[model samples]
Target: MAWALLLLGGLFEVGFTTCLRFVDGFRNVPWTIGFLVSVTLSMGLLEVASRSIPMGTAYAVWGGIGALGTVLVGIWWFGEPGTPVRILLILALVACIAGLKLTAGH
Candidate 1:
């Protein structure tokens, strides 16, 4: 359950980050609102998940998911470069995130 919440929260983190890309420094009203809402929901879910999950594990996983999601979205949706090395590093990060989850007692 906590991991599930962490996943959801991390997804929201991705949402907020992607929205940030489109916000135009908070000047674009709709995107700004999306950013604000996503950030709020992400943080709220993180806090809730922390209650049952170890803080370090939860945080690391959340951040990893957010980073992974952001990178994928950037490459797929924003025309960011997706070089071989970059993709390999992203996969390594996924492995590390999985390691953390497997070792975490939660």
Candidate 2:
């Protein structure tokens, strides 16, 4: 359950970060609202997940997922650079997150 919450939190983190790009320096009201809502919901879920997971592990997984998802979204949706090294780095981070989760046994 906590892991599910953490994953959901990470998803929200990706949503908020992507919305931030659309905010156009905070000029777009609707995108800004979306960003704010995403941030709030992400943080709330993270807090809940923290109850059962260690802070370091949970935060690393959360941030790792968010970073990886955001980068993929940027590449596929926004035409951002998708260098091989960048992809490998993201993969490594994801592996680390999975290792931590698996080792934690929760």
Candidate 3:
């Protein structure tokens, strides 16, 4: 349950970041609101999930998910480059995230 919450929180982190890209320095009201809401939910979920999970492990996993998701969103939604090297690095990051989960013991 804690891991689930943490993963969900990480997804919210990606939401907030993607919203931020459209926020236009907070001048865009709707996107700004989206960013705020997502950030709130992400942090709240992270806090709750950290109750049972080790803080270090939880934070790393959350951050990894956020980074991975954001990068994918960038490529898919923003037409960002998806070069082979970049994809390989992203895959390595995924492996590292999995390794952390496997070793976290929770």
Best by TM-score: 3
* Span of 10 residues, lowest total lDDT, candidate 3: 97-106
| Candidate 2 residue-wise lDDT, 34-105, digit = tens | 999999999999999999999888899999889989999999999989999988888898899999999876
Steric clash pairs (candidate 3): none
Provide TM-scores for the models.
0.96, 0.94, 0.97
Comparison by TM-score, 2 against 3, better one: 3
lDDT on C-alpha atoms for all candidate structures: 0.94, 0.93, 0.96
Q: In model 3, what is the error at residue 12, expressed in angstroms?
A: 0.5
Query: Model 1, which residues run further than 4 Å from truth?
Result: none
Candidates 1 and 3, the one with greater lDDT: 3
Candidate 1 residue lDDT tens string, 41-94: 999999999998888888999999999999999999989999999999999999
Over 4 Å off in model 2, which ranges?
A: none
Clashing pairs in 1: none
Candidate 2 residue 99 Cα shift, in angstroms, is: 1.0
Clashes of each: 0, 0, 0
Cα error, residue 24 of model 2, in Å, equals 2.4
